[model samples]
Target: MALLDRLRTREATVGIIGLGYVGLPLAVAAAKAGYSVIGFDVDASKVERLYARESYIEAVSPDDLAQTDHLCAWTVDFEQIATCDVVVICVPTPLNQHREPDLSFVEDTARQIAAHVTPETLVVLESTTWPGTTEEVLKPILAQSGHALGRDIFVGFSPEREDPGNATYRTQTIPKIIAGDGEAAQALMEAFYGAVVETVVTVPTPTVAEAVKITENIFRSVNIALVNELKLIYDEMGIDVWEVIDGAATKPFGYMPFYPGPGLGGHCIPIDPFYLTWRARKFDVPTRFIELAGEINTNMPAHIVHRTREVLDRAQGRGLNGAKLLLVGVAYKKNVSDMRESPAMRLMQLFEEAGAEVSFIDPHVPQIPQMREYGIFEGRAALDPGRISDAGFDAVVIATDHDAVDYAALLELGCPIIDTRNAMAKRGLPMDLVTKA
Candidate 1:
């Protein structure tokens, strides 16, 4: 049967790569939509959890995972790609040391697919990257299979719009932005994605879809940088930036609220915007606003560290050196165990560099995992919030605001409190002892 016909009838064997956050939820969603799903990951532990019916991502419920286990299969083997009628790549595109687009993961996955992909199969790249990556990079690698695109095979690009902690949208609910290399690939892309998501928005080509994703992140990065700068200016003038934002947000049409934080976090906001910044360098185009936004956000953790030291010295008559500090949360955001590009790691390093000892407590993230920038803290476990010692602790910093934390207890410790998220103010707590950083 033709790939499009098989896809429409829910007879397609969907293969999803890199089953971390995006791929796992997509795998489960495909299975729930009555399609056979094969989730591929290099992490053996993830495969083991799949067999055990355990879900590592919050977007995928454990009960839903257990129910989908009958139709969904997970493995580390790439050889099974031949069995799939539709293959979707959902890998990471992190930045390199010099902060350029690291397309290594996408290139490696494309090579793997090229080795085992069969005729009449549809391949979609869901990883965020440079605009031309789908046609300019992936298509050439896929052509190595000796199958012509829009003839013997089909390929496309669909940027992932995954909001990890969002309560409103799921894989099935969010609108899917899809594009293909050509007309034949477009039909197949529509067949597969239209079956899985509530809405499928098809664009002219992969470049348009990729650009849409980049523009979205760029909007966020620039706005966040604006607010972070405002926070600094307002702090100097003794005006509450949060109150100003709240008042501005009351005007219905003109203003959309973007909150300032200790720093930028999550996979998309901190990293994806730079993909454009790096690509623009080739054309000699200057992205001054975006670059300034990146600089402001990047320096926020350092600013926070300096502010903490100043607040502590004023309140305790001592400095950061030789002080014991506790961090309220370590995850990227509230109520989620995602810490990709979180600012807490940078804060820890800065505090330690200033001769202060730092300990973190996150209800969601139990232990720090091995990250590229902060691997030295791999085995460190989160300190129990309830059992915190008041003897040596000089101050507590609220980096992330999870509801599970007992903020009142931190107040009881009789130390300076730096509220970066304004988590305390949101809860109607007194701001007397809390210093808004």
Candidate 2:
């Protein structure tokens, strides 16, 4: 009741862990809602940028950061967790080498909160993870805080619904799904999130909320796989899958359009399905459809490479063994800088393995930062746009279609191109040298 009182009065200190795409926006929204916000991240650079009133994520602007100057604080210190009334974990929940759900970031964050948390503080996990992780994983760890679970320490799960680079929806606009361990936890979570977001949809348990998040992504993965497979089939049959989908879209009943791409990229759709697959195995249930979709999506990059090789051979009479390629976009999605699992990295790896040289140019990604899975190309910079004409590329592969790119310039080179996202055709560019992969 006291925690709810602080939340309703805007006197609560909201601590957000992992100030990336999800955390920063939520932190800003909560601060705007009149709560004192403390953003915690191990990346000191992010903290520095936040303190400088600069935002790295496109969703949060510099003006938004400036507006929160009075209420928002950024820090790399977990010791500051002791002073907060509410702690929300928004860290990455990526998969390990074997494609198993890796909760190391969430676990480490929970440990830090457990070490410094005070009595009667509310804690919630906003990171996407397997069902039951709140009660099974987070509560046991937070129990070490020397406080009662439901009485002194409240734990809950509120899955993040962050759509990077989306102009229409934001953290405060997207309907939030939340669940708590106890009745008190549920009420506190509702009071906290209801103040920050436009709507709060509470489920009976944390596991259901967890499923809600993963189900949203799994639906996307399956739909994307269906379209990708259609792309392959239509490509072989000399039909444009994009055209078919476009025509089908006009009917507007019993059909939704999901376009084909080079591969599944971004943090959610490509990774969240596996979390369910791994968890389902424990129950002796097999998610064959999900696993099949994963397999289909996983092979998309290779299919693009094969098409590039075909273009190289047809135009220049050479294989990919010694081709030079300029990848158009490397960001996981268009118009966004976040590339947690961009398939472009895998394409780079595959191109090099086939003896081809890969250089990428993305308006969103100026320099390839060090990634957890793809570290070999760390610190690699994007190609200079001015040099594209005389860059001597065998084929240009458009992986992501950011609007800022000059697709027309590549046409002047008279070089063959592999168009994955149908960016060229969509722009009314001639298909003389363009091959849709």
Candidate 3:
């Protein structure tokens, strides 16, 4: 189809699978661009919520529903997508028990699409995955309908660039990188997404687009590990690592600062790089840097636990058991409630195993659900200084530096604090009472 055909007809119905942080916003964007959109998800509750104009995702706006105005609807039925002009999949690609890429969600989506796929409909995989997944894994399954690609049906890959809770960027502003199996497929994808997004760049092939996404995340993982490693080194010399980082970042040309914390968290930064490394192994290529970065990032939570143990040992040789520990935040990042693969949960589990009673407090997240490890501990219901001061916690661990939290008031609580995020330094707390890791 010509670009003009899409612009004039407006018959381009967009079907988005997985009504999540990525899919919901993208569907809203497409609907705002004058295309009818249908969103499908396995979770019926999420589909029901979208119909009621209730957004569980932080990136979507309340005005988005009003602006779209009956242009979009969500469904759990897979058959409804058969009428769509374009389809996009944006599900989570989480790690399994052994830390391997779990592609079951992707496989399930492909099987569903295969049943409803028809000629001339464009299918785009927006979920982050290993290179060649679009052409190798998804294509074979989707072709089960006996439709040939580039002629009978079209397929492409476009990785989602979603920054949840970011004030400056949104789905419409972020540039999209897309590629397809052939020229016709590329044109269809570009036309489909270009109407919703401001800028769309076409790469050589779908594999290149996949690699671009992985490289962007791997760069972040590697730099974060570098800073976390340096924090430990600088701490031994009694030099404030946060101060040193701020000083070094003053140089305009050479430095891009990545801060240190208890450990890496969030769904993408901690897991996306491993998808590439796992696939690279089949090609007989060892990604040493990726492996080393993963090693450093994964070890950070345990290192923080070890440092906490040392701090307690110095106080009175009191083990983690029988110690009251307060984790400052449960969310992976500041101000966002996404807890998928959060390191704070891992730290809590490790602390509980060592006999410490762990609890957390976050204004955004009023409750932290109990896992099998940490049985049942309610988050401190209030951030009042009096409440914190009266609480009998032996130590406090700063995990997330949410703007709503008053670190000054927390310091007034008088409990010794383990400043994992350097939040105490940002609040100008005295070094006598704060220990940074």
lDDT tens digits, residue span 174-193, model 3: 99999978898887877788
lDDT of 3 at 289: 88
**Using lDDT as the measure, which candidate wins?**
2
Quickly count the clashes in candidate 3.
1
For every model shown, the clashing-pair count is 0, 0, 1
- In order of lDDT, best first, we have 2, 1, 3
Shift in Å, residue 296, candidate 2: 0.5
Which residue segments of model 3 deviate by more than 4 Å? Answer: 2-4, 7-9, 369-386
Residue lDDT tens for model 2, 65-124? 999889999999999999999999999999998999999998899999999999879999
* TM-score of each prediction: 0.99, 0.98, 0.94
Lowest-scoring 10 consecutive residues by lDDT in candidate 2?
Answer: 387-396
Clashing pairs in 3: 321-355
CA lDDT of each prediction against the hidden true structure: 0.91, 0.92, 0.84
Q: Evaluate residue 374 in candidate 2 and report its C-alpha lDDT on the 0 to 100 scale.
A: 81
